[model samples]
Target: MDARRNDVNPQKYYVKKLCKIIYFMGLGDCWYERTEQSRMQKILYAIWATLINSFIILNTINELLAFLRTDLSVKEKNDSIQFRFAHPCLCGKYIFLVLQKHRIRALFERLLEASRSVYTVFEVEKRSVWQAKLCCLVLAASSYCTLLFTVVDAIVGYFTQGIKIRTEVVLYPTPAHSGLLINLLRLLIEVHWWCIVTNMILVDCLSSVAMVYVAHKLMIVKLYFQNLRQKVISNIGKKSDLEIQKEYEMDFITGVKLHKDALWCAKNIQYALGNVYSIQVFESITLLGMCMVKMAKIDINLTFILANGLYLVCVVIITGVYFSSAGNITYEAYEVHNAMFHSGWELAHLSPASRAVVLVAIQRSQVPVFLTAFGVVVLSHNNFISVVRASYSFFAVTY
Candidate 1:
């Protein structure tokens, strides 16, 4: 009964912590915080709880295997949702070590390559245009095919499966299901669940891509600024106003370059926050829209409406919390702005020959942003298509 006793015991403490880890990793909430319990007892409790809950989840999924075979498993159907709920892939335990030894160097190598390719205009370069377009087209076609398949499958199921097609109506009935208003609310709630899950997944994926790409872009910009900073420092012996200003510009650029990686990391955080912002807005609209549709479809508030509403609220809150940590996107943009002006200033101060070189470097620096923006716009459009298809299933039920 003395849980505290177990706390002092390392083995017991380890087990308890392990259980909490398991629950936190997959399960939504950790209602079982062991403080008063003894170390040994807490450890045992955690191990037992984790095993039991995991078994329940596994068995439930297994029972639904047949249904999943014909329909989508919650995991498959809810890929985006599950993906969003999971921790970012960037936060690995060994990442810092990898970054220290390899990632940083690798990033620098990439920057070097980017720098070498600075001769071409970023947006209008003729060399890679067809290649980029081809890639984009291929990606778009694949995503479109997937979306079409999901749509056709859902439509076929809606017509063939009869009334039982509404998974919420059959499996999650409540006392109020007998009422028309309550059934409609239940339907709305189910729709909300699916939408939230899918949207979150999309946002997570987009965030990951944005973070990595932005980090690389920032790294290149940082290097360029660093070169300028060094140039100014080298010229410090010549103390004329132009030289001093050049030196000052160099120092400013150097600072920007030094903070480039940090700024890049910050941009990723901002992108993730932007994702949260957009997802929250979408979820809010979903709930409100679902409520109106509920009245039209079943004539009452579905019983699960409150539960789904609470879940949505929690998601919104948690995402908002993440967004809060990310701070402002504009801050990173401003830093980039400063870097640009300084680089341009350096070009102006340079001899005609050096000015040409600086101009090329500046042009090259803009390439990554242009390409990334274009990629995101295209990929996200595909994601939008998926979102539409996923929603059609729930709509079929109402029809």
Candidate 2:
């Protein structure tokens, strides 16, 4: 997870991680150019990915069938809450993610191309950006390690301990007893489950990166606006009033243009993640409710408690990462507006052209710019809180 000393650009660092994830997921390489060799590579990757991911899809169907076949009375308490409700909800999230693989690839492709073009600008990264990148990497790496250790212990437990259904590994419908074939199937399920988690992690990282880009741009606009007067005076220190006003107008226009570009990028991010927001908004409560209710229950098994606890924390972390990064965007956008408001633009003697340009920037900045899903659920801390509160309500009712 540590970035190489030579590798400093967080943009490229995340782009590489994204490409690897999508590649192994059986989606083609988003970073590479089309060539004969790359084409063949894509084909091979598709086949390998198809073969592995097909197992997950099949197991998901089996899970649904098994859940349905169980009687209503049997599902009331026990471990059924998770195996029946929570797991399926998570799977539903992943299913929508998987179903839009093509759209995801296209989205990544556009960003990949844009990053290549703007690599020089962001080459020397800021400390805050680097820290955010590392935070994301750590979150994802830790999640994987947790699941990996659980599976390894389960595997070892299978041979050393006894034949038992590992609530962690054998999440899907599987026989309690282990055999060579059954063990192989369980192994596949574990690997596929890991991939599903990886897919979500990678996409979330990508979203974080996109939000970071927009926030950075907003910060630039704010800084530029704050120094707008100084920059113009320094450039035309001895110029006439007319000349100075003209210089200010040009500087103001450039700032507004950059602000517009940043908002455009944010809008694109919203479009790409619209469905994800819908899923997170609508289904996260149900998922978290299941986890909380299951966790609150009087369960003697340590593994059960640990699994549900881990799941609940992971869900909160993922949702928080998405919303918190997005909330920063809104916060930063406001800073831009604040800077412009105090920029002393009104004090300057400006012609109609300069005044009109200032008004344009003011008009745009009047409405706080933030990403939203379907123009409803703003990706900010408020909605994040709302989701958690609703989940807690569900838990309280069920408990």
Predicted structure with the largest TM-score when compared to the true one: 2
Q: Cα RMSD (Å) between model 1 and the true structure? A: 16.9
Candidate 1 residue spans exceeding 4 A from truth: 1-238, 241-256, 259-304, 311-335, 342-348, 365-398
- What TM-score, over all chains together, does every model reach? 0.35, 0.81
**Candidate 1: Cα lDDT at 259:** 43
Q: Candidate 1: deviation at residue 225, Å?
A: 8.0
lDDT digits (tens) for residues 1-399 of candidate 2: 011233355655666766667666664554534435677876777789777667656765555455443332221234445545544544565565566655555554554344333222343245446855875776596667657555554545457545353433233444544678877776666566676566666656666776776676677667668778665556554777677777677667766776776676667667666666666555567778877765565542555455556667777777777788789889988898888776656646787777777877787797887777556878898889987898899888988
Worst 10 residues of 2 by lDDT: 115-124
RMSD of each: 16.9, 5.1
Q: lDDT score, residue 139, model 2?
A: 58
Instruction: Report the lDDT tens digits of candidate 1 across residue range 29-68.
Output: 2222324657897577677656644543333233233232
Q: List the residue pairs that clash in candidate 2.
A: none
Q: With candidate 1 superimposed using the best TM-score fit, by how many Å does residue 298's alpha carbon deviate from the native?
A: 4.8
